[model samples]
Target chain A: DVKVTQSSRYLVKRTGEKVFLECVQDMDHENMFWYRQDPGLGLRLIYFSYDVKMKEKGDIPEGYSVSREKKERFSLILESASTNQTSMYLCASSPGQGVVGELFFGEGSRLTVL
Target chain B: GESVGLHLPTLSVQEGDNSIINCAYSNSASDYFIWYKQESGKGPQFIIDIRSNMDKRQGQRVTVLLNKTVKHLSLQIAATQPGDSAVYFCADGNQGGKLIFGQGTELSVKP
Candidate 1:
């Protein structure tokens, strides 16, 4: 069984505050992703890392940044939190070699910005 | 930007009945697709997947059918149980592994 662990299951931040969400995967997958899910909007990709220290901006990367300092850990940073940035954030990982691999996800972090 | 979307936003079914959820993808270049189930306050869980090469795939109690011609995908649940209630999403990916997800369909299983 693959395990992806998130640092926080719930968080609340004030406007203009910095927020960090951490994720770690035990399966040694090469691909890591951050997504924000909203009602009726589904899961929109924020950022993804294919390898350690490598990253790519996803569809909705504005106001968000990510870090992949090590192979097993990925972090999402909200430079300045705002009410519009509040959403359920999810982390996922997948093997690098497969053509169409399934992503194993961590329990999401529900962030509320006030 | 390519988009993946669902036909319905919600579906309700009785326990022991079957449920079908539909999704549509706009990217014809997408070669792979996956179905996911997400419970409230939880991340999305992988259900089943089907490649462009195959039209159908089955799992323990779920089946995924893909129609490339219409760019449609469907997930069918057999003997729906309370645990089967969740938001279902379909994702399309090219060979590069970047997945574009659809607006999910929320399933409500009634006893």
Candidate 2:
């Protein structure tokens, strides 16, 4: 089974604070994604990485950035958290070889910005 | 503008009954479809997937039907149990590896 582990299950941060969420995949998948889930809007893509040192902006990437410094790890950075940034963060990974968007997700990190 | 949407936001069913969740996609270029289940305080889990070439696919207690003509997708759950109560999302994907997910439908099972 594919295991995508998240660094924090729950986090509370003050407004204007920088936040970091880490994810690691044991399957060594080449494609990693960061998404934020909210009510009604569903899971909106924030960023995705196809390989180390490579990243692409998703639909909603204004307040976020990502780093794939290693094959097994991808990190999402919130430059400065705001109240609107409070949401559930999900990390997912898939094989870059031939897979077509079939992703295995982490347990998720719930972020609360005060 | 590519978008995926669900016809119903919520669906209620009794235990041991069958449940159907529907979704519609606007992009004809999409060639892949997937269904995901998300429980409270958890990430979405992959339930099933189908390609454009196939019209129907079945899993353990689930079946996926695709209608390319209408650009529609449906997930059918058999013998719906309390465990099946969760938010379900349908996603449209292509060979390029981009996925557009629907808003999701919340399923509730009553005993």
Candidate 3:
């Protein structure tokens, strides 16, 4: 069984506070992704990394950034959190050599911005 | 424009009955499609997948039907149970290495 672990399950931040969400995968997957899931919008990709130090913007990349300093670890950062940024964040990883888009996802981190 | 969308936002069915969820895609280049189930407070889980070469595929109690003519996709669940209640999303794996997901349809099962 592959495990994608998220560092935080719940978080609360002020409107201007900086936020960080960390994720790690044990499967040596080369592809990692950050997505925000909302009630009506479903899951919108914020950023994705195919290799360490390499990042690409997804559909919704504004107000967010990502870092992949190590192969197994990918982090999502909110420079200045806002009330509209409050949502469930999900981290996912997939093998670079396997099926194109079969992703293994973490349990998700719920963030609330006041 | 590339978009994957659902026909319905919610579906309710009685336990032990069959349930169907529908999805539509606008990109013709999309060859691979997937269905995912997301429970409350959890990330989406892959339920089934189908390639463009084939129109129908089946899992344990789930079946996926694809219609390229209309760019339509459907998931059918047999003998639906309470445990099957969740939000279902369809995704297209045609954009290079990324997947574009739909809005998702919430399924509720009545006991």
Candidate 4:
């Protein structure tokens, strides 16, 4: 079984504060993704990394950025958190194998920006 | 921009009944599709997947059907259980690993 772990299960921050959310995967998958889930709109991609030190912006990457410093670790950074950024954040990883596009996801981090 | 969307936002079914969730994708270039189940306050979990080459694939208790001509996908759960109650999402994967997710359908299993 593959395991993906997020640094925090729940977090609260004030407006304009910088926030960092970390994700680690035990499977050493080559693909990592960050997504924010909101009511009505569903899950929207924020950023994704195909390899270490490489990242691509997803559909909703306006106020967020990501880092893939190591193969097993990926981080999502919010330069300036706002109330609108409060949402459930999810991290997922998939193997480099082309055949399987399945994503194993970690327990999401619920962020509340006040 | 390409988008994936569900026909219904919510579906209710009995515990012993079969559940069908439908999704539509706009990207004809998408070659891979996956169904995900997400419990309240948790990340989405992979349920099943199907490639463009195949029309159907079955997992433990779930089956995924894809129609490339209409760009539609459906997930069918046999003998739905209380544990099957969750928000279900369908995603399209292109050449790269990036997935475009659809607005999820919330399934409520009635006892």
Alpha-carbon lDDT of model 2: 0.92
List candidate 4 stretches off by more than 4 Å: A97-100
The digit string of per-residue lDDT tens for model 3 on B5-54 reads 99999999999999999999999989999999999888889999999999
Order of the predicted models by lDDT, top scorer first: 3, 2, 1, 4
lDDT of 1 by residue, B80-111 (tens): 99999899999987735688888899999999
Q: What fraction of the reference structure's interface contacts does model 1 contain? A: 0.76
Best of the candidates, DockQ: 1
Better of 1 and 2 by DockQ: 1
Off by over 4 Å in 3: A97-99
Q: What is the interface RMSD of each candidate, in Å?
A: 1.7, 1.6, 1.8, 2.1
What is residue A33's positional error in candidate 4, in angstroms? Answer: 0.9
**What fraction of the true interface contacts does model 3 reproduce?**
0.67
Q: Model 2 over residues A4-101: C-alpha lDDT tens digits?
A: 99999999999999999999999979899899999899889899888889998889999899988999999999999999999999999999743567
- Per-residue CA lDDT of candidate 2, range B1-111, in tens? 689999999999999999999999998988889999999878889999999999999999999999999999999999999999999999988725767789999999999
| lDDT of model 3, residue A68 | 93
Model 3 chain A: weakest 10-residue lDDT segment is A96-105
Q: Which pairs of residues clash in candidate 1, taking residues 3 or more apart in a chain or in different chains?
A: none
What would the TM-scores of all predictions be?
0.97, 0.97, 0.98, 0.95
Query: Residue by residue across B11-93, what tens digits does model 4's lDDT show?
Result: 99999999999999998989899899999877898888888999999999899999999999999999999999999999888
